[model samples]
Target: MQTTQIAPSNLGVTHPLDMLTPQEISAARQLLVEAGLVGATTRFPRLLPVEPTRELLAGYVDGDDDYDRSVLVTLLDTATGEAAEAVVSVTRGEVADYRVLPNGEHPYGQPQYLFEEYERAQQIAKADPRWQAAMRRRGITDTTHTYLSPLAPGFFPYEGETGRRMIRSLTFHRNFEGDNAWAHPVEGLICHIDLTAGTVTRVEDDYAETEPVPVPLQTRHYTPEHVGPARTSLKPLEITQPEGPSFKVEGTHVEWENWKLRVGFNAQDGLVLNQVSFRDGDEDRLVLHRASVPEMVVPYGDISNTRFWISYFDAGEYLLGKNANSLKLGCDCLGVIKYFDAFVADDDGRPVKIPNAVCMHEEDYGILWKHTEFGEAPQVRRSRRLVLSYFATIGNYDYGFFWYFYLDGSIQMEAKATGIVYTGATFPGQPNRHAPEIAPGVIAPVHQHIFCARLDVAIDGDANSVQEQNVRGIPMGPDNPHGNAFTWNRTPLTRELEAVRDANPETGRSWFVINPNRKNYVGEPTGYQLIPMPGPRLMAQEGSSAWKRAQFATHHFWATRYDPAERFPAGDYPNQHAGGGIGEWVQANRSLENEDIVLWHSFGPTHIPRTEDWPVMPVDYSGFWFKPHGFLDENPAMDLPDWSSYQGVPGTDVDDAGCCRH
Candidate 1:
């Protein structure tokens, strides 16, 4: 859904699930300021719409217009390194709740980095005498064009740095203006700066006495002008919908075919689908209450001092939606499109609108069903799907999240990973176990892009139960006469601990969220199966920092009783926290029987870079599928229009390639 569109108004919010508009953000900031909560150094690290309670939304109808709107703003006092969270009701023009964040005690963590901190960190690094001396040792004196990347420093028990607002920087030299900074890496020099104190706390130079590893100086340009001549062999392919699209949009509520959902965006989670329902016959059956990819961790595999503590929680630490890309037509998407504008808070707690932040459109998906009988005309139907997608850039990597709703009562979420791979400097043909040399003198460390998706299951209604299904081959006995028999077993995940399961590809494992109260035509519980594209879970050893902090990625699936406060997979703030989130929530071991349950499925690719992944890496895809199991009585797409009506021109000769030649 990547296309350009005019930014919408930020004044009218008719629904409780509507995203915070520019006016609402300003009002919330004003309320905080009036309450003496916002000081000169107070910055908005995060702001999101407080999700309305279900009871409040139960009676909601379109055009109700007078609903309550609230914003939850996370405030950080940069001068004192203090943090607090406040909830302000924009409708009532009052502060609802406020509490100081426990960010200075044990399991400490700082708020997300401000956009202005990037420039500040660069200046701090360039001005430091120690950093400048290290640069001089490498024969580089011009620091005007140098780029000091502000990176999240993973938690460590160091004396001066523990429980402090900090940012670690890596220098990248640019030859001149418009030059790609990633091409030249200043290896073996790391700068640690205390953001609150505005001073460099520590400087690590691996080459203070020894010879330094030469930086990768080759111009690894990816842009068109730098790459010289462009390829002209390909022809332009155009897609158009002359009569316009079939989907209808009113505010954020979208309706396409039988699908109905509200598009939601915020600072943390990029795209959230709320109240997803599918029309079955005359009833709009509830499929999911909400769904979103809330958090993901990129844990590098290298053990060098430069990158050993290098696990990054992109959503929690950097905020995916806040850094989302403004999509362009013909480049990011095609066909008839609709774009949704997103408004987020900046450093000063002001409204910042990201125009055309979300993309929505339809795609032609090959054949849905096809058959050619021996003595009958061929029957075929072309498949079409509605796509809602967005892209976000975090540091060097770019990620695209695409959600598809198909006509056959199926849903799919895919994450496309592409961009420049994070690199380090190494001699050509150097042997490195954890980091692979993708290009000459450039090493790309092995890493995993583990994404956790939260699916609030509502098969027929809210009272649903999750059951693990495994298909196993039966032994060659009375049950299996021919030794090729197989049987499947469904084990109810009765508790949170029981639901902490992993994928078993050998047994064809899957999980089903079933409504125990609703029975299908065959007397089976109406259910939707979660099919995982199983891959290796977290590769970090047990008890390691990465394993402890990102426990959500350790298991392929987890089901817990629905709780509004239990939103993020890795707790509220995972920037430098010790460990929380799912690992702590399941301590209660809540029951999962006939109750509203949310499914957390973690899956992604464990990347091992190769030569082909050099300057820019192609898209590496990973995701899961949700489809109707026994929820539908029959094939949902059986009534699809057949494509066998088209007849070839009379007396026309057709070639074997399905082309007509006269």
Candidate 2:
């Protein structure tokens, strides 16, 4: 709990877009305490750095000290369920703005749960008489090892709990301290606990009248100690950079190859890229102003009373960066790595540092381009990419968010989903349509992991427009004499309503952000295309609870005129609110022609559990690409070193690693 002492004199080491340092976090908290905003029950649920305005940044040099630095802290009173947002200026050392959050009104939504609330919910559930009676009926007398999972209670108009801050608890029996709790789910029991009152309002006990479903006795342990075995076939493959990595990091700014960007992290979004640009010739053209996956919804497809109301907004409800994993060397990252430390506020409003929170390294991508004449040696150049990534563990699932920059002026965002699946107990070999049996008695309900990425695009500059391009096939006519001719059509998305579209894989659909003021060598607008990995959108029926809460998932693409307040695709407090995010934003139907705009892309997998997903699931990947369609005149990687130059002579001991040498 030792604090890092920071002063205003050291602010030069940070950019306006950098994540708040431990010193800045503590300074903001001190300003709040001085303003009489801190109470005994007041807790810091979320704290994020407020980015400077575009005008301010346009005038900023690399080490300018006049730019503003601020922090936005979300405060919750755990005793009364009250919430408020405060903006503090660390540079000016004062409170700039403060407002109370209306959390007790209709369509109420509570702030995120504190770390202490998880233990509080467990204590309340175990102390309930009805839950205890149900456990005794199941003949589980030893309650010391019982684990009560604190789950979010999606918004429902149930009596006595309509406007109250609540968390629903599900019981799981653990045999011992290190036992896996998810493997032994106690079916047909739900405990509703009110956080403000510190009591269990109601308990649904299916075993009270009928026979109880037995908890699965299988100990699904995945650690090496429990499953005693070692594979010897694999040989050691060491990835050592005898020279250093190709990327340079000065504070939060990164420069690798022709790509330059600023790194940021917060309690909600784990990693953020700002002021991203690719060097073309002597100029650095802007591509994106800011980019991050701000929110995601994981909704289970089940009709059972045990899990009917289950849709978790991972970033909005439980902060993603708050639960981020401190990455390891060989396990999570390889090669010579550059680590960035992240600082977030704890419940007591103190700075907690997550060391090695962001990992940066270079990866060899096989080949860039190659071609050879009939008689000449093959001319080939190796491809490489700069990767920046971070991982977050939420409940039973762990997610890794990665951002990759290639030498060809392309950017890609990938999300890796891996961990134990959420399971429920049932009869052995039971045939359930909604829930598939992943194990003998364990059934994992079908679910979807939908992630929404916020891209504040700056194609050439801020004045950009969007166009949807789809491939069209020509019928047999003069235009297609051989019946093998097809062309593509680009439609202008001039309004917000027209911009909310879905992916059409059959047409090879993609969206382009183009700057009308700037033109490439071909006389077309300089543009960047957004190519989607098309998949099923949200399967929930329209007007359903899950559908209403996660409207962003219903479409694969959304474009809106840029606004700083519209950072989160889902509304700020999506914990228990009625639907109100991108669903409501597009209703404005504002003009998007030649304006500064933001794009929200929703994409992920709709998972149907399989037998191979048992124990611990391997990494499932889903992502999209933002490539330079016409942003550059030609291939920017033509200057890459030729690998054909490194020829192994007959009697000479030549290492293939020499190909990397210029």
Candidate 3:
């Protein structure tokens, strides 16, 4: 007879078999055995000292001769009660030429062994099919017409015996402010050359003693009368007739969205101070706020430095468009301006009919604009503007000076400026060698060193409404024809791996051998030479099996470049402080079959403050020197001996023996 049974929910019964699956239970037991959790034990030799007497440190500093300081630190290994390796730190002591050597030490010198090995490898690489294929991928081919006509027409011989007259005109504009406020005279001068003589003649400033400046030839000319009426009248758009000292004035705020902005102004002496700021903000922030212009408290000279001018036109909608924004349409207008001065006729010259008038616009917030009439004169007046924009977040502002002149008659804007301070890289030995190795045969030149740099950026107004334009030199090709390039890729990991294997069969292998001591490999493209070993495939496995599998032994160490300054002088310009002063150990050499992996184990960037590191960072250092072992049948005939059998002389003690006692 069958009996029905009901499970009890509150029963306090548990079974060990219910805890794990059969496979999981087996794994647990194996882990315990591997960990020696039951009875795993290690024994040490009696004759050898577990630790050394004292630790030592050593390093070199790069800086001015008097200021650069190398430091070393030592510590006792607490485990074995002996001195381990000494820590080393190097600091720049004085400010001097970083390239000059102080103590007659050539840090960038090439070792003879490295050079010879590199040469031998280069020969082998010459016959490598893979290397040849990479070179072929980098070659360029032309598919378009090779020649094109020049823009300007050439001059022909005149029919008559009349000589061609070359006329050149130069115009100088000067604004003067009284001595009580500003001291120096700022001058803005422009020279135009008319080259009917086959080539454009240089314009010489005989009176001025300064550097020679290049002014391109103009092809087109515009006149004020041709430019049409002013976009906005000189009179105030709206004026508040105040009844008392405190009165509100209505103003219009014009937001310039995604515009290239620049500012500058002519000094009383004609000198122009200009700056440029790129607009990177949302539409809401671009709105120009209408506010009464702040009254100038001091004379023009006293407040000139605070004043600025701004002018911007959409490059795509204005300059590049067939029917673009023009002075006649009044669509092209200066965004802001601080001051305006009327043109006056000189006493020596006839009544100068100054038809051209300048316009000034000030949007609320911190923006100003100035617009000048563009047309033909006796000569073209070189108009230059300066713009200044500050980034609030990055705490840095760009000062841009724009020079606009008629080139072949069309207006061209030229930008000339420099960036501010930031952090840089620090490379211990050679700077160039620090750059990444992209190609097989290309070695980063030896003279290069690493540096740290910081970037300070600021965008005004709505951060979202900014526009990006005018980018150059990006690589977009197979094999990346450009040596150093990056690409945006959208692919699944499995697909990417599949594509890699499809493209390069050799790259699909479980392990690849590299000789860091040699610069390149010279040989035909062939399969990797596998080193025979007795072990489960560690390099090919995915888990603890790989950890248990061993092909050869390896070691590592750590070193540091001591930097004294807490902060860079110019903040962080280009994200220069990312890694600080630490560098990782690059692989030295590797061989599979002969158990020939010579690894330099090293430490990474970690902040562990010791007693000597207090007040300031003291020297910290670590290194690894390989003790090669023999694995060949000819034992003694092998280049390396059995380092495991090495023993110290009587009474001599060695520290760090635990690191190598296997």
Candidate 4:
């Protein structure tokens, strides 16, 4: 049932999980077992998708789960018995076929690996004397040696076949105030485990004169001498949808006014939107085929073996969505909200529910349109947007992502980075000044959260082209003219390298993905403009670990020809990738003129911690957007209703206004 109104009821909450459920997960495992695909010498079976396909869900209906018509499964056969990822198909509870895939095949989604680290940590803590002592120093006994997910040890050719060897740099949790794990850090310890042999290969217990510092969450901790006790006296706020919600929900499909989008989840990419389009007067026009953060590289400034060698590809190395914290009303979001649940599997191939993994709602966005003449009352209308958002708790940091669809045919994308940072221990009262110390004897390393989103742009039709718009001032030449005049030098970016450019500080350059076939009333082509908010690009030097692998991040904008095989800028297996992703793709310099194209936009923050950011950091934000460029005849937001009628001033009655009393 579609419950548009805001009511706290299971009927309103539960929806069929869009991804593969536990039954299907079990089925995949069993199919491999029946085919004798499992043996002692083989690697653990991992079920995954064969191809990157964005199929629109069969129209959502009441009492029905959003069932996918067919399933294409890929199994990573890492066992010595078989090393290639095998492809299998299943339709309506029946196994179809099996085929050995080709090289560069990283189809199986890696979600269950992170969970395996917890058990591995407990086992190492009990077996290794150093790990035991490190835990002991923090009062962590055998009963509670819970471990934080370690940094993914990136693969190098020297470390051949790292798929069998899982290296996790461990941290201890100081869960306080009912917060999830990652409140504290048992710094300066890293554990490398051989997953194939199921043994701890090595443990890093010491670093250059630094000890394992343990910092606890103490947001409410205070001195009794001059402080009030912990209190909660705030009034309750509720958003009751008396007339149901304006947005009609039919499973994963959400329809409100002119906007229509299909939402889904990936173990790595988290909230994904497909077939995003808006009604342009009579017909629907395509904006983007698929949109999600495919690669997120968080590189810490500290370069120690335990910290320096770590560069996190959160979306790939760690499934960011798998780390999502279940959201709650009044805390995560408010207003008439509709929730969507995400489904993924645990290490045992059992399905787990990430409830309320994505939230959708309409919010008042202040003024949509407002205008007034001199000494005249203004006419104004409130603006509103349909917001779809989700968050991921990636160990020490929590990142909130949002996609906002405004009434005026503009889309704004934003990411908010919060939560505590991973730390290293120091001598009490002798913290290093270069690295910001979160607590006594703790160093919170400075880092950059660089995220790249893959955008498949289809404006009006597939034959769309991209143009770079640079505003240049006119040179004062003949005719004795001054150099005050400027014109937009719009040039067609016809190839991959031509599209690789930076946001000009002089002109604030923007790229417009336009359709030459479609024109507005004034004969100008219809298009959407991509404008990036100010944020520092990747600052790592050339040949540096951070720079070499994530070279896609050096530029804030990119345009590539649409190829099904090319989805992520940082490649599929980025764990120890030696720069073979976007850099290789663009270096080919493929033709980009008048063909299907994908827009890759990257935006993020470089965090240098301060005293105010300790305990928990206030949310830091960065974003970009798609604005209409010669696409419409007039401002679409001009349709907003006149609000002078509801102007609550005391001058409604003209006769009495002449002598009105206070």
Candidate 5:
């Protein structure tokens, strides 16, 4: 390849050395001499007078002494008329071979053979079309190129002594960390500035690789396209409150709000059963007189009216026959309704009884004479009281509820619990290494860890909660309809084609190919569908925007539950089948290592960081709250000492080694 030269005026016009003071010029000259540029015989005209005889004798004796000297070329800012540091490079041409030294000093020991090889590579690179394209894309249009040339000891060069020169390429470009700095390894034979015209010269290369290098890039914005029709519309419900009656059963208080009876079975139970109704205002609605159950176990089996019974004492009649003594006579028969009130009137403007036919069990007397019939039974009970308490409360800001049941037969009671919904974060992964194609000069990487959230619940009671149950959706293997499979080289969908298209747009196109062994979490089917969107385009349409769109749906539901051990172990439910104890909450009280939870939260869907979310985050409280839940005994007497009331006695300290004494 032929070498292009930028004249002296172009070299020093924006060069720094031209603006240096007289003393600085002297120092720079001395530096150049030390750097093997000027010869020892070259006298400083201002410092000493040169003898013509001596100069002539020296020149004749060592005519080629300065043939291999170095030179310093300064670079200056075009806007400022001040001295800037001079950049130096070396170019050596011998016979048919040529070499160019880089602008900066080589930290590695210079190898002559390697330097020659670099020069040859530069020649090839300058003629490479691919390299030119790369440089153009990098926005490097102008090159104020410089090189080192040998200088003679005399005032002027003699005939045919125009010295050998070497071209070294150098330019100012941004560094790896985005800071402006001089780029290194200026061996490439790029075209430089034309001195007189102050314009960059161009070079053409035909012998380059035909294939372009592959570069991966991510879009700053993504627009999602719908793949299928809308699944369902969300419906809103009104909040319902509890009501009816006032009673104290166990440690819970029950009251009537509207037509419904509100009851509290226990403080820990919050409030149970939002609404309870009664047929008559005077009759009691299932009250529990006593209850005592063992810890960690739910009571089962029928408990009707054995030792427990509701009586109509006001009507002077036994509403439910009392059986405080029978073991085999279980309360299982309590479900049988003996009589129902009838609104009827008779003769003389006075109310009279028009009883309905009663039904009763009969034993067969003989096979031939066996018969059954409806007969009238006397009206014994008028009204009765049913016993049970129900109420609920919001705890730790999470929607949770506790239930207590006092049966009509056994002395044991049962408690049931449940919790709201939540999702957990994924495990950390490796860093991304892909680089952008269009902007190779600008570097960015793919980041992992997205779409994650958490909830915390608190339990304030005697028993601890255990994770006895777990429910996961489909395994979401590489073939699953979710986009996660398509992203990681996963194969085609295993589900129905319509469902797949509706759920995952990344794989909606039949032409899209992926690997067959990628895995992901295929959560339960949410009422959503993915859709196809436009691919990235190199140019914007006329009167159109220039943003690329994404290709998938981004919505789903997550939840958790808590219940009795027997009812737990249920399949496909959030935290279902998990055994329960007293006052348990879900997703609360994270481990000690999470002390920074309130300080730093992981980034969400948006990868960009803003200045507002800093230092510590806002409050994130969750779980159930208990009202009138016995934190302590109701009215216990105590002259409690107030620790906060104490004040320090000024100048009253005793010996430092001893305990505090008056």
Candidate 6:
């Protein structure tokens, strides 16, 4: 196998790195069968927990370099005669003991169970006489393919959890001649499958249109025969290293420029950064205790049986670390990059290596500072950023998660969504309530991608305060006749409920996390500002199951006292989880003044598809940043030396190295 130059091993990325190892993945598979919960012809087993337990993981993070060797493996037991949800403890390469997560209910949205049921649904759909007749009418042969992608019914299966069930929405494509299968549609057919019975109970074959609406299958964008021309850049620039990469890594700890932190992969969350600190004056000071993506929800908005109740809590539903996408050098990342790897299960329960799952590098962001004083030499400094990113593909959508440290003492967290949209078929001019049509007989439904970032703010010390500073125009009745004056109301959010404030566009509200005891040169307390980026209001209405489960998405920002137990906003098991998470935890109404605090920021964007968004989507981005407000005396990047003698190529720069070539 080919390898990238600066792989994680070269960066000192090591074991006990938080990601589930190959040995642990194999151990988990073996432990499942050893516990007698493996799925058989009649019996069914759905993996529920296959990651480190929170109780044990916290100890490793808070304590010294030593690690606790234990893994938590949980699953659903749905045999033909019996049914229950089980949790098993695996420690030191052996099954220690077992317990149940909740009293009496089955967890939803385990991929293995859904995959098996979807395969079974295919056979049952073929047996139906109406289905056969439809196939004949459409001249559906081996060339016209029929397949199903498993969908969470988003609600309780029939008889209130008697057994686990799923909805398999069938997609028909024209595959006989070429690869433009997506251009064709097998309109409006779905199947409901019962996992325990191993049978398709109901076939929602709604013959909506008189004839099956078929879209063109020879679109050049998808057909293999008409591949697009290669987009080539004549001048290729490669990042080089004379000595080595500027960044230093000792195990999971990383150091570059003035930034230092620990990076690792989690079985559920793809990337986790801990104990983030930056150079203060003579020593490094803590900014955030821990930072990571806790949860992400993708909720589709076509609420019929086939599309309704369809929301995937991505990091939770599909373990991001398990499906980490490998890096491809010049494409996924550039510059002198460092890559990280993790382990996951293969088809036969054997462990396989998922290499280059993470990439780190440095690049020029923009201008750090610039100024001109009359006739004096113009002063300018170029900006550089230390970036760490990882990609994960859950189903058809791929997300790129990034953390950037700027020379000006600012930290930016960003998520980019890019991939093929989840879609269904429709008749001509069929009214779409929350979607748009891309091609004939096809509808790309409306959906939202909501992401939440958890940051444990530890400024100067553990004790910090959050103040909501709102800027608003003064009323005419006050001092001035004209309401031109603006006033900034600096209000301290003392309680958790008070901190659960909305992002007020009218007031331009932003929160400041300050360390009261730490004052800068002018005897003023230093702090960083939390600015919520602009985005859409969540489309999931009140009373909807998705909205109920994701109540934390209602507001833009939240502040609560640091508590390791309160990690995820949508709870650990969001797939049909009976509420109780950040929305409930906030009710404790704990104080947030001069105490150990954590900030929860939510960012979301609604996607109503357009024609241009076919085959694949352009990257849609959303982000928030922690900027040094009063924390820095001046631009910390002032230390960057001026490029006094740099000169650009004159005639050659306009074209290239062209005289000899010409």
RMSD of each: 5.8, 4.4, 38.2, 8.3, 41.4, 6.6
On residues 1-662, what C-alpha lDDT tens digit does candidate 4 reach at each position? 42222221222222333454555555555665677764544432233433334432234444553333223343443222133343433323335565553333332123224465556655754576766666666666643535556566654433433434455656655443344344355666677765545556766776424444545544322235325665578664444344556798887877888888878776667888877888877887778777887778887777555677667888766667777767753246655567777766554444578878888877778988777889998778888899999999877788999999998899999999998766655556765644676666556777888989888888876788999888877778763287667787889999999899778768978989999998988998899999987577887777886787887789988898888778668775565455567878988888787888999988899888776775567899988899877777777777666645644433221111122111
Clashing pairs in 2: none
TM-scores of the candidates in the order shown:
0.95, 0.96, 0.14, 0.82, 0.13, 0.83
- Taking the tens digit of each residue's C-alpha lDDT, what string does model 2 give over 1-662? 32223334475345677787888888889899999999898999888888789998898786566556889999998878889999988887778899999888866888887888999999999999899999888888898989999999998878888768899999999989999998999989999999889999999987678888888989988899987897889986656565567888888889999999999899898899999999999999999999999999999899999898999999999999999887743357666677788989998889998878888888888988999889998878899999999999999999999999999999999999999999999988879999999988899999999999999999989999999999999999899999999999999999999999999999999999999999999999999999999778988889998899899999999999998889888898998887789999999998888999999999998899898998999899999999999899999999998756756342322122221121
**Candidate 4 clashes between residue pairs 3 or more apart in a chain or in different chains:** 4-245, 42-79, 43-79, 155-576, 303-308, 304-308
Among all windows of 10 consecutive residues in model 1, the one with the lowest summed lDDT is: 1-10
Question: Which ranges in model 4 have alpha carbons more than 4 Å from their true place?
Answer: 1-27, 38-84, 92-114, 133-149, 156-164, 171-187, 205-241, 328-330, 428-434, 475-480, 643-662
Cα lDDT tens digits, model 5, 66-152, are 221112222211222111223222111111211232211211111011112223334433444644564455444432231111101
Candidate 3 residue-wise lDDT at 90 = 17
Error of 6 at 487 (Å): 2.9
Model 2: lDDT equals 0.88
Least lDDT summed over 10 consecutive residues: which range in candidate 2?
A: 653-662
* 229-263: candidate 6 lDDT, tens digit per residue: 65576665554343456689775688988888888
Best by lDDT: 2
Off by over 4 Å in 5: 1-454, 460-463, 470-662
lDDT at 148 for candidate 3? 12
lDDT of 6: 0.67
Residues 582-653 of candidate 3: C-alpha lDDT, one tens digit per residue = 111112211122122211111111222222221122222211111111111121112222323656332321
Query: Which scores greater on TM-score, model 1 or model 3?
Result: 1
Order the candidates by lDDT, highest first.
2, 1, 6, 4, 5, 3
Best-to-worst ranking by TM-score: 2, 1, 6, 4, 3, 5
Local error of candidate 6 at 147, Å?
2.4
Angstrom error of the Cα, residue 153, model 6: value is 2.0
Q: What overall lDDT, based on C-alpha atoms, would model 1 receive against the true structure?
A: 0.88
